[model samples]
Target: MPWINDAFWQQLAIGIAGGLLGIIGALLAAQLSSRGKPKKELSYDLRIERALPEIGKELAPHVAIRYKDRPVPALYVVTCKVENTGNTVVKGQQIRFDLTPAHPVLETYFAPKPEPEWEIEELPETEETPGPNYRFGHLAPGRKITIKIILAAPEEPKVEVRDFNPTEHVPVLPRTSTARANVQVRARIAVALLLALLVIPQAFYALGSVGDIAAPVVQLGLVAALAPFAPSLIRALVHLLFRPAPRINLDRGIVMYDGEIRGVINFSGEPADVPDSAQTLE
Candidate 1:
């Protein structure tokens, strides 16, 4: 009865109530932040080139001809066209093209075949994606341009359009949804820690009681105080262990409109005519 005195029970009850209030406060704060207006918005209009032969808008790969004795694996004149559809001008923009071949023979054929008006830069090769990155400094609204790259492979090559500065046209997210997401992540961590705090010591007490190492009255008081939060503790454990994966849907047509193009090799062949051409875009 000494361990179950009035002061002991009173303190335990206050601790449990304070923890519950803390959880409720964190949840309310998260909900309010989500409903608040976003702090910054990124909006810009750009489109990649696609086939419209009638209007002369296309992303076509033309095969170069080989005369009788001329041996060529396969040579394609890969053309990428990008246009500005938004009202604002895009400045200091660079387009990154990624080339990955299913066949190793095609690796030797990828090179920047730039047009006179365009400037090109060759990016250092990486193990995962080895190709050149072409820079287009500025694009005026409604202005379109074509970038031609020479690809010599045994099969049809694939190209990708990326590295445009669309954010240059819209406000950057200094703080807003990003802050909210960070706060939410902290809340989850807090909840997990609180549950572990509540459960682990009580579990030790239970084991102690079974082994005759704990006084009965003290154990009873702790159990009564913690019983109400058992369901919440279980839920916290489940969420911590089994969170869902984030989903992303990328549509090349929508993401790279205004002349960004991505290409992949669809055909296969030997490395016989693979061109040893690797040049930096100037």
Candidate 2:
């Protein structure tokens, strides 16, 4: 039988240390590679143009007034501007507007012009909310387009905008072009080396100590062998419990094809005559 000598224990300690060191080095490389990767950002600029009176039937939807105007009574031309402010170009974008009238005073009092350009599809009469779905073409970086909607109302209507659609699993970002492939290769190598350190040394120790050590010692050796894998096991458990979810920034805007929104529009009008302010005829 082989002697359980001091050199045996020394080699075992060195093997455990080497395995731990390999694990640490692998983790550090993975973190560094992730940090060096470029970040991808999706952002846009959305602006609501002011209401302007139409010049005539020929230019029914066009508004000459570019400045913001107060919500008032009458037919007002409303324009919305959507701009791509990020590095990537946006394609096949669809935006939805939801309009809600203020109660008995304003309900059923709103009317919008019928035009295909406005893309305002009226939902069933039973539906309480009113608005339109507008389709926008591809927008290059730093590019913008204006959408016009003609609305007639006695008071301001509420409007809301919803653009973000959330999904699972965020896409992995790529490292810099020059180092991408090299980094990936190094990452795989590190992982493989770490696994070898964990498995090879444990096997050698178990085989060497066999028959020489008692049953309790063998159990202890098994525990020691598995201890090196605890970190990875814990990480796997954590990842299983809490997987990453995609983030959608509605206010910041998204690059998707379809979106929904709501807002309020007040029509320009004169308030009802108040007894206090009413002047009696002389």
Steric overlap count per candidate: 21, 25
Cand. 2 TM to true fold: 0.28
lDDT of each: 0.45, 0.43
**Residues 216-239 of candidate 1: C-alpha lDDT, one tens digit per residue:** 333344444445545555555675
TM-score of each: 0.29, 0.28
Considering every candidate listed, which one attains the maximal lDDT?
Answer: 1
Report the C-alpha displacement of residue 152, candidate 2, in angstroms.
0.7
What's model 1's lDDT at 33?
A: 40
Best-matching candidate per TM-score: 1
Q: Which stretches of candidate 1 lie above 4 Å from their native place?
A: 1-71, 102-129, 164-282
